[model samples]
Target: MSNTKLVINYHITEKCNYDCQFCFAKWENPNEIHAKRGLSEQLIDQLASYYIGSGLQSTKVRLNFAGGEPLMLGKRFIEIVSYAKQQGFELSLITNGHYLTTQFIEQHSHYFSIIGISYDSQDLNTQRKIGRIDRKNNQLTPTELARRIKLIRHISPNTEIKVNTVVNALNWQENFTPLLDVITPKKWKVLKVLPVKNDLLTISNQQFEHFVMAHQSIAAMSAEDNDSMTQSYLMINPQGLFYQNQIHGSDYLYSPPIIEHGVEHCLSQIEFDLNKFANRYIKTINNSHFLTTNTNIEVNHV
Candidate 1:
């Protein structure tokens, strides 16, 4: 009944390759059993089944690969993407761009319509120095990271390659300009860092202030550079997490909380009257912020 299509963010791997202090995932390796461990094929199959059964066949869907680092579950992810394409759906991935390899990209190029790679120069040294706890032996560097982005562009030039960065205290002012210099030619995207509890991505209040200022500055300059493009965008964390959005009155879809209910349930349940998705966004924001603020207040009082 709704003309709006759903962009489903499939959180395949909660395990990341880098232990960046700013990472919000808090992706500690529990190393649990099959169901409890990393993203399992079972979860993928369940998601695929849910999509098919929901009669949301008319829904133009894009399966966004979210992660600790999606490539950590490389082969499995490729298989899922392949399955989705076979069933007539679009697939995309968001990565840290560290584990990228020529062979892997070549193999999976047909699977994904787009690939988003994240990099933050402020956390550059940290990523270089340490390995993600899940992948303890692996470490990534800026040059290597840059090389991956270039290679993705070169190999899969047709594939939409987006460099995604979280603008916060460290890079917002001092280093962002240089980062823009490198990425803007590639037409990369810079996103605002949304607040998350116990998130490594959390910057101080001062850093956040600079981030907004830098964002406004970039928006003004970008208007002159390309009026056709909207550089900043919002993404829903798969658990249906709320992040910041400039368009308060717009629809921002999220997965229904009940995994068994599927997409049709979500569509039917959402009351998109005059306010559209604004109602849902406000509700989520209020709940999440309340919890976050109370937790912080409790911590401070203690």
Candidate 2:
């Protein structure tokens, strides 16, 4: 656990162009903090002060911006991540890749240590069924995805690329090896779709395992079943509150706003298992080919 980095997944906005059925970025609060720059900066300062400035010598903090689509925030998203970088926090972003333009990548890719794109299925019909298509029915094809990855790699060679796939009833049997071989992501995070809103897209445990086993040859591949996902992450919702998913329920438990109640008090309100968090990322840190030369290792990230 000594080498484990503290990851803070800050879901800056719940608004998304594509409405995936299994999407879990629902906070229901219309008053999101990202719209209020002052409040958002205040929250970031609190996080920086406690996690980085508070003399936690053993821990390095990574601020990962996530959302229904963080890229939808456009320039404001870049502004927030830039501020985080300025504060000496390692940064990352998880987006659906619809708005990841080449120009943006060329200019702002340097702000992140990593950029994770959600790519569920290679088949267009499956992607459409999963609601991963945008308003114009435009889906991010594998060719375009690979192009974006190449651009990111060329623009900022040090910025690691990651692909996140949610194994659902629609895409569980699809093999991603062909596309993954082309992009060669630093990591391919395969996750079981949590029935947070509905079980319509959820897949069976056996089906999930089948997908992981099928992709065993990918050196950067990792899988996280629902059990390993629970209480294994430190997440902040769009409202600047600490939130955690219940192991058995669709509902999420949340703390009071971090802007209102400080980081220490707010963290105490949530159920964050340090051991689970460590176990979740330690394996990733160990098996990551981006961090090491070992290509035979496989791990999980919650």
Candidate 3:
């Protein structure tokens, strides 16, 4: 039996309205790639069938929508979610929250189990250095961001909220606690900044150290409070076009997996060993050589 949970992360379109400096998706001249609007209902059905036929039929496979901004796909997202539910799959979507409006939230709140929003501040000096937010389109203020988050909660109380923050040289240490103050006591999650090689932004050893320290600190807080209300989640680029692990690296530099026979063709190749992966990604950074050498953790090779 394939015990691995099937998480399908789809990049609907590469075009983004905002030109955030540090956008991992690395939207290069958004004009180059025509924003492919909602996928035809037919392709949606085919995708559904492919997943179901590949033993994802009964599993609580997650459907995640990502992109320049997934919500930008508009009605296609709703259609896909409806179809996924009809097949009994859970749903999730990651967005910049720049396009998030009350009307958009109201229309699709019930369909998703969670909605992830990415926000970095408007301080141009801070934004330009890290390249996380578009200089021009980085219009949403922190107050506006807080308001949008509030509306999402009000519209869909059950839908968990996750905030993806990329910790870089400038804000990794100083801004973390402040960002936490904003997220805690609410449903939110923060992702450590992972680098994509050759992208406009690269992660150096120093930045990595700061990020690891921040993660360790937050992880400890989450442990002590019990009600820490913070969690870490993964969004793998099925195509491997982004990060080696979607959540860790830069979108511009990473290569998404090639889906030839189907999506599982790529999924089956992954070790699917969460512990080992964590040891490699999370532990290796801490310079804790113990876990690195302790390969005794048993996992099915195949």
- Cα lDDT of all candidates, in order? 0.49, 0.85, 0.51
* Highest TM-score scorer: 2
Residue range with the least summed lDDT across 10 consecutive positions in model 3: 222-231
lDDT of 1 by residue, 45-107 (tens): 444565554665535556677767777765656665666576556788888776678787766
- Alpha-carbon deviation at 16 in model 3, angstroms: 1.1
Give the TM-scores of the predictions, in the order they appear.
0.61, 0.93, 0.65
> Model 2, residue 144: displacement in angstroms?
0.4
What overall lDDT, based on C-alpha atoms, would model 3 receive against the true structure?
0.51
Candidate 2 weakest lDDT stretch, 10 residues: 288-297
- Between prediction 2 and prediction 3, the one with superior lDDT is 2
**How do the residues 1-302 of candidate 3 rate in per-residue lDDT, one tens digit apiece?**
14445555666566566665545554444331123433333334445666565664536467777776777667766766687678666887778776788888888877888787766444546655554455463655666777877787788888877666654446655555555566542333433344443444434544534444444534322111101111112333323322233333323223333333433454444424344323322322323221101223221100
